[model samples]
Target: MPPPALLYALAGIWISVIGLRSVLVEEHFFRKIVASNIFGSGVFLVLVALARRAPEGPPDPVPQGMVLTGIVVAVSATALMLALLGHLHDLEKPDNQEDPS
Candidate 1:
């Protein structure tokens, strides 16, 4: 109901749109990962803000903690995924037998 909540909702909407654009218009590996990350972050932020808006009584620390944990886990997962992809890419190096030009 606050200004910040409205801002978070708007940001979430924009981020979802950007992610959809990347999936619809981009065909690059990097773009896919970047878009996925943005989407994930936006969803988490919206959930966190919603949790923050819960009734004042007792307050829900669970959601707050979950969002924090999700953030760390998501970043680590992204790094591992990218690293693995890079390793696979290195293995697919162009052979001297043929030119990609």
Candidate 2:
């Protein structure tokens, strides 16, 4: 069987590439946010995979902690981006008081 690191690294590269492509191609704000989250997840996957170098030893805690922190930060940033997108959309809406004709 292939090593865990190799598998994880491949998956991370594939996922990150896909995320990057989506981010570049998509025009909508929500799609871009989702793609960025996917890219971040791939980065975390690579970090965890690096921590598993030896088969006999336990994984280090520092990288794991950083990954967890990154997750939290990514979530908060996504939420903030979504809120800003919503506000911008609301502002762009034509005022109801204006004449439709």
Candidate 3:
């Protein structure tokens, strides 16, 4: 029966640690990209949890705005990385196959 804030904070920290490990241990570019995204999400989760601590005050816009911006950036970066991976794969495929002509 931990408090909701403690639970959220712990979860965020756990996710961040996992993400950091994946980024460090994995050699693949795709895996690194995903790990980075996970790390960013963990940061957002922690921030939201902090915001919840001050329920008396009006909700803060700064944290919300930061999280929103982060999400947009992360999505864009992932899309770009995926596109690059696809292009690289396509280029490598021709080299692996024997010429049929």
Candidate 2 local distance difference test against the native: 0.88
Clashing pairs in 2: none
* Candidate number with the higher lDDT (1 or 2): 2
lDDT of 3 by residue, 1-101 (tens): 65687689789989988999998999998889899899888988887777677646665678878888888998998899889987887887967756799
My TM-score estimates for the predictions, one after another, are: 0.71, 0.85, 0.79
Badly placed stretches (over 4 Å) of model 2 are 94-101
Model 1 lDDT tens row, 3-97: 57667867877787787678578777777778878877777767766775644555467887888998998899789879987876778774533
What ranges in model 1 sit over 4 Å off? 23-25, 54-59, 94-101
Candidate 1: clashing pairs of residues: none
TM-score for predicted model 3 compared with the true structure: 0.79
- Once fitted onto the true fold, the runs of candidate 3 whose alpha carbons sit more than 4 angstroms away are 95-101
lDDT of 3 at 94: 61
Q: Candidate 2 residues 7-94, lDDT tens each? A: 9978988898899999899999999999999988998888888778777679878888999999999999999999998888778885
Query: CA shift at 97, candidate 1, in angstroms?
Result: 17
